[model samples]
Target: MSSIFESIEHAQAQLKELAPNQWNAFQQFNELVFKEGALSVKEKEIIAVAVTHITQCSRSTDFHTKAAKKAGASLKELVEAAFVATAIKAGGGVTHGTHVHNAKKTDASDFLYARSNLQNLKSIGKNAHEGFKGYTQFNAAATTEGMLNTKLKEIIAVAVGIATQCPYCIDVHTKKAENLGATNEELAEAIMVSSVVAAGSSFTHIAKMIQSYND
Candidate 1:
């Protein structure tokens, strides 16, 4: 008897009709990503490559490796694209935590101290991938927003990855955004979104403090 995934693979191969739920979900999501988007076929393939990395979905990565080549992407370019994803991913972590902690304070109350504290947290987020899985869903979901035009949004996905701190998302979006034409300069610029919002979010601390005072 074959394993469940094998059965799905066989069904997927034969166009037969009996696959498992996880298998089905994967297949359905694959269809959605490929069939309906403003992105091109090669673009989607590259995104899929990144998705596999961020999701840490082994099979998805395998599929995209083949697909990217099929779509005419060079192996070296694909690797470089993935590198771009990782670099931005490293920076996004701090931006996210700083954003989170900052979003909780208001009126510059402890703004200076909080900025310092958050800087520490952001560093933790970036490196959390060494032995953690805190923010993959958060980052991966954000990475799905490939619809925007500015390179900033792409880097924002890295920031999201930082917030969530998932290596997989970091891997995928870094590459996907680049393949979508995010230059190194553009990639660097994209990360600025994290800085802007993270700093601004500190101002939200006011609302939190007010709510606490009322309580």
Candidate 2:
């Protein structure tokens, strides 16, 4: 009987044989995206680890966790990156509550189309809204000048938003990153980093499934 652990190698070999061109292209793209550019290779790998966690890519989590370590990211820095993703994911839900609070008097359909009515949140849920403000401040503090600067943290935020498929977050962080002097090239590279990690996650998980089935 085959072991699940051995299937990853087998699946990769089969993929390369079945679609050599596509496989090669993907490999090339991955190599290109991780190269040092607007963002350093170390910074890119740190962002990759964050995106992997947000995408919940177990395989990628393993890969990037090691890559980040190799790139000289300390364990504290890695933990901070993970928390940035956590903060954004939680904040997305909380911010959306503005729409919900505003729609209380309207029909349910109105809630679906409601934009962020933050003012309404202030009026309707003062305490909770204050808590939201506190969270926003915390998020700002977390991403500011520290082991990771604001610009890089915002780049990481944009990548996380893209991986999580949160438009609000993408808009917010992309603009914030720009304001903090992140060039278009840097932004594009950050997004590309996310794309590769997300795609890699899918391939690796499928490999895991194949391994299980063969076992």
Candidate 3:
């Protein structure tokens, strides 16, 4: 397998080139965030680690497992993240299981009585047209050209999935990105960016809680 990192020195080197003022600002931000936010960077890293586990992103699980440790996250935090992810996945499994259980009592012809419904679903193999008749349109104003492409968009989706702890989105985006030929390295970087963004969002929650507490 590829190294968890190409090398640690490389990651530190990239960190060095950031604008000093910006880096300082964000570091100060994350410091307060670590203490007062709904989640610490440690917690965010823990969640990201669990997401990688369930999504089966081998490189990501490996990298974030170490990152969680380096961030001072505890085993409890990691376990919590896993529980949340599993809950979401198990909920989905229950829904699918119900359909399978009903299959025994329901005839296929009756279950899908409408020919059109069956055709549309069965045609998924040959046609995505009906399957994606109104797929979510990207915001033209928010995302620019390079970001809107398939590979890059999948990268962004994976980032969002990790940061948001959304298992289904994680599964979709990981598969899509791989199908589009995204390298393991690029996906890892995208996820790192997402982790920082998620950490920042925790600060928003902290502010809200502080405001409420003060009031």
Q: Which candidate, 1 or 2, would have the higher TM-score against the true structure?
A: 2
lDDT of 1 by residue, 71-169 (tens): 886775456445445544554543445555555567445544333454445455566675334454544443343333334346545544543455544
lDDT by residue for model 3 (101-176), tens: 3355545445432323323333332454532332222122212233134455455556656655655556756887
TM-score of 1: 0.42
Could you give candidate 2's per-residue lDDT for residues 96-164 as a string of tens digits?
Answer: 666655556654444443445544546534766677677878787767677777788898999998888
Give per-residue lDDT, candidate 2, residue 46: 91
lDDT of 1 at 194: 31
- Sorted on TM-score, best first, the list reads 2, 1, 3
By summed lDDT, the worst window of 10 consecutive residues in model 1 runs over 194-203
TM-score of each: 0.42, 0.83, 0.37
Off by over 4 Å in 3: 1-132, 136-147
RMSD of each: 15.6, 3.3, 17.3
The regions of model 2 sitting more than 4 angstroms off are 1-6, 105-134
| Arranged by lDDT, best first | 2, 3, 1
Clashes of each: 12, 0, 0
Which parts of model 1 are misplaced by more than 4 Å?
A: 1-29, 99-215
